[model samples]
Target: MKIAIAGAGALGSRFGFMLQQAGNDVTLIDGWKDHVEAIRRNGLNVTINDKTFNVKIPTKYPSEVTADMKMDLIIVFTKSMQLDDMLQNIQAIITDQTSILCLLNGIGHEDIIEKYASKQNIFLGNTMWTASLVGPGHTQSFGDGSISLQNLVDGHASEAKYLAACLSEAGLNAEYTDNIHYSIYRKACVNGTMNGLCTLLDADMAAVGATRMAHKIVTTIVNEFAAVAKHENIDLDTNEIIEHVESCYDPKTIGHHYPSMHQDLIKNHRYTEIDYINGAISRKGQKYGIATPYCDFLTELIHCKEDIVLKNDPVIN
Candidate 1:
């Protein structure tokens, strides 16, 4: 299978390495000039569970794609806000036979991707994988994660199943799910809470969980998501979701790790996907007549944090 890892950052690189390991023809599509050059010069440098290695995969800039590059599958890992731009930039490679599996964090990516690919060729999913981009062309990947995905339309179930099977052969822990929305929301709860709170406090999951107000704050934020999910007919169980989220705080899991948002906003001074996570929930809450005070506040604070960091650096976009 010829697959393209769109937005080849940390997690995308990890997926590319795994798929290549399974002997698939893999191409990495990214915009970071330094990172792309590093890979082109010296293969992708990756460390998994303390073991370091390199994988040689073809890399491409979206604009530099060739006419012969029609992809069989495109696994999108672009950041939420940049999805549309990445699609437009890579439009030449996407053909009618191409199936898009969006593994982006947060919500509403299917809406954006629909503008590029037909609904029948689109799939929505989420993953529990974790990785950190150490530098250009280098990534440190750790932890275990699974992917759950579903087709947007029933007519495409066979293609979605084949995609899932192919990914599982690469040891990605991929599963075709009938209720992908629930799985996505389940993962989003983790991002919405751990990613946002950790970035703001400059703490890891354990530190946030150690605080006395953890439950109250988590519940407050989760209630807002649940309310919004209800409007979508997902019927989220707030208490169960809260427990699943708090589990990230356990040291045996991801307790001591700062999430991707922290890596983006604090360490790298890049803008985060707050508008897609907590901020998305907050907006949906308003549309659904649900009060999302916590999400609204968290969104404001994250944006404020972004502004402060950008003001100090004034170079990042």
Candidate 2:
């Protein structure tokens, strides 16, 4: 399979390296100049379970993509805000048969991708995989993860299955899902609660859970998300979701981990996906005449932090 990992940051580099390791012809596309250069020179440094391998996969700057380049699949891992620009930059490689899969954290990403790729050729997926950027061309991944995917257009079931198989072949456990919208919402809920709170409080999941009022705060935020999701016909179980979310607080689970938003805003000094997560809920709440004070307030707080960070130490990449 000819694959492209668009927005080749931490998670992107991990998948690209693995696909290449599995003998698939994979190219990584990113806006980060240093990362592209690093991979072009020394290949992508991937360390899994403390085992490191420098897999040589071709890396390209999005602007470097030409009409001659074609891909069977393009997995998008860009930040929510950068999704549009990345799609525009890599339009040349998207042919009629090309499948664009978005594994971005948050919701409402497929709407933006539809402008660049046909709905029938698009796939929606979410993963439990985690990756950390060690440097420009290196990534550290831990444990195991699974992918849930479904075609946006129903007629392409065979094609969707093939793409899922491709991911599985690369050791990325991929499963075809019937209700990808629900999966997307489920994944977004995790980010909305854990990632946002982690970034805002400048703490890990355990620290957040340790607070006496953690359940109240978390329930407040998730209820807002649930109210908005209800308007869209997604009957999210607030209690079930709350239980699932709070499980991250266990030290044995993911309690020590700071989420992607923390990596983006707090550590990297980059803007976060707050608007896509809580902000999206807030916006939808207003649209549907629902009150979402928690989501609204969290969105503002995260943006304020992003502004403060950007003013202090702006990120270059």
Candidate 3:
């Protein structure tokens, strides 16, 4: 399969390497000039479970794309805010037959992708991998991970199954899910609870759990999300959500990690996916006539923080 990984950051680099290793032709499309230049000069350096190796994959900047370049699949790993722009930039490369899988952290992206491509060409998937960019050409994967994917529309089952098989064959352990929306909301609840709290408190996963207030805040936020999910007919269990949060807090699990949203805030980026996560719940709550005070309050707080950070770092937008 001819694949192009958009964003080509930590996660994209990891996927691109895996596909190349699995004997597929992969090209990394990214806007980071330094990273692309370094990869072209050398190779993509992947560090997994304390071992480092290089994988040879062709790299291209977004500007280098040609209208005639046809890819079998394009895996999107960009931030939510970058989605529209990236789609516009890559418009020339996407054809009706190309499959586009978006593995982003927030909501509403499946519809966005469908606006450009047909329903059969879009795959909704979520992943559990955690990686961070160590350098221009290198990425470090932190833990064992897998992915689940499914078609959001009724008539796209065959496309979803084919993509799932392709991902599993490439060693991603992808599973076909019947209800991907619920799975996505489940992940979002966890991210919305942990990411902002970790950033606001300025602590690692373990440190956040050690505080008594962390439990209260996280539980409150998650409860609001769960209620919203239920109202939307999404199968989300509050107890399960709490357990998932607690499991991530365990030092034996993902204790040492910092949430990606917190990382973006620290870098003074103007945008965070909080809007798509908590804000999504809050918006749905309004429609369903259910009150999501926690989500609304948290979303407002994050946007206020974003405003402050952007004012200080004018270049972050």
Candidate 4:
């Protein structure tokens, strides 16, 4: 399969390297000049299981993108705020046969893709893998993971299976799921609770679990999210959800990892998917008459702080 990874940051670079190693033709597309230049000069450095390996693949800046090369699949891993512009940048390469899969962590991305790509060629997926860009052209792999995917509401089963098989052939653990929406929400809940708290408290995954109040705070957020999930006709167990969140902190698991929200806030970026995660819960809570004061306050606080930071010192252009 000829694959193009749009937004080749940490996760995208990792996937591109792994797929390329599995003998699939992969190209990485990004606007980060340093990363693209470094990868072009010396291959992408992938660190997994405390070891580093170099994988050579073509990398290109967005401005260099052309329509000459046909892509069977394009994985969208851009930050939620960057998705629209990323889609616009890739218009020349997308065709009727192109499959665009979004592995981003938020709601409303499907609508954005539907506006640009044909519904028949779009797929939605959720991933549990954690990654970070340790430096330019260097990606740190934090955990062993799998992917769960499905076609959009207006899609066909055959397409989902075909795409899943392609990813599986590329050595990515991919599977078709009937309940991808629930899976998305489940992950959202986990991130909403863990990511925000870790960022606000300056804690690592394991350290977050070590504190006495950590479990209670996560329980509060997850239970509130479960209330919203129930209204959407999805059944979830709070205990099971707690276990899933706790597993992230296990020493044997991805223990030393810091959540993306933590990294974003440290970089003083204006956007965080708090609006999609906790903000989504708070929005649904209003409709169901469920009070999610914790999520509400946290979402508002972060937004206000980010607004101040961006206003004072706008992101480097």
Best by lDDT: 1
Please state the error at residue 155 of candidate 3 in Å: 3.1
TM-score-superior candidate, 1 or 2: 1
- State in Å the error of residue 5, model 3: 0.9
Better lDDT candidate (2, 3): 2
lDDT of 1: 0.90
lDDT for each candidate structure: 0.90, 0.87, 0.84, 0.84
Tell me the TM-score of model 3.
0.93
Better of 2 and 4 by lDDT: 2
Best-to-worst order by TM-score is 1, 2, 3, 4
> Which lDDT tens digits does candidate 2 get at residues 70-185?
99989999999999999999999999989999999988898999999999999999998888787889988767788999999888878878889989998999989888888788
> Per-residue lDDT of 65-87 in model 4, one digit per residue for the tens?
79887788999988788888988
Model 2 TM-score on a 0 to 1 scale: 0.95
**What is candidate 1's TM-score against the reference?**
0.97
Candidate 1 per-residue C-alpha lDDT over 1-317 given as tens digits, one digit per residue, 9 for 90 to 100:
99999999989999999999999899999988988999999999999888988978899998898769989999999889889999999888899899999999898889899999989999999998888888889888767888999999887778788889999999999999988999888888889899999999999999999999988899888888888998999988888989999988988767877899998888877889999999889889888888989899999999999888898685664
Question: What's model 3's lDDT at 259?
Answer: 79
lDDT of 3: 0.84
Model 3 residue 213 CA deviation (Å) reads 2.0
Each model's TM-score? 0.97, 0.95, 0.93, 0.93
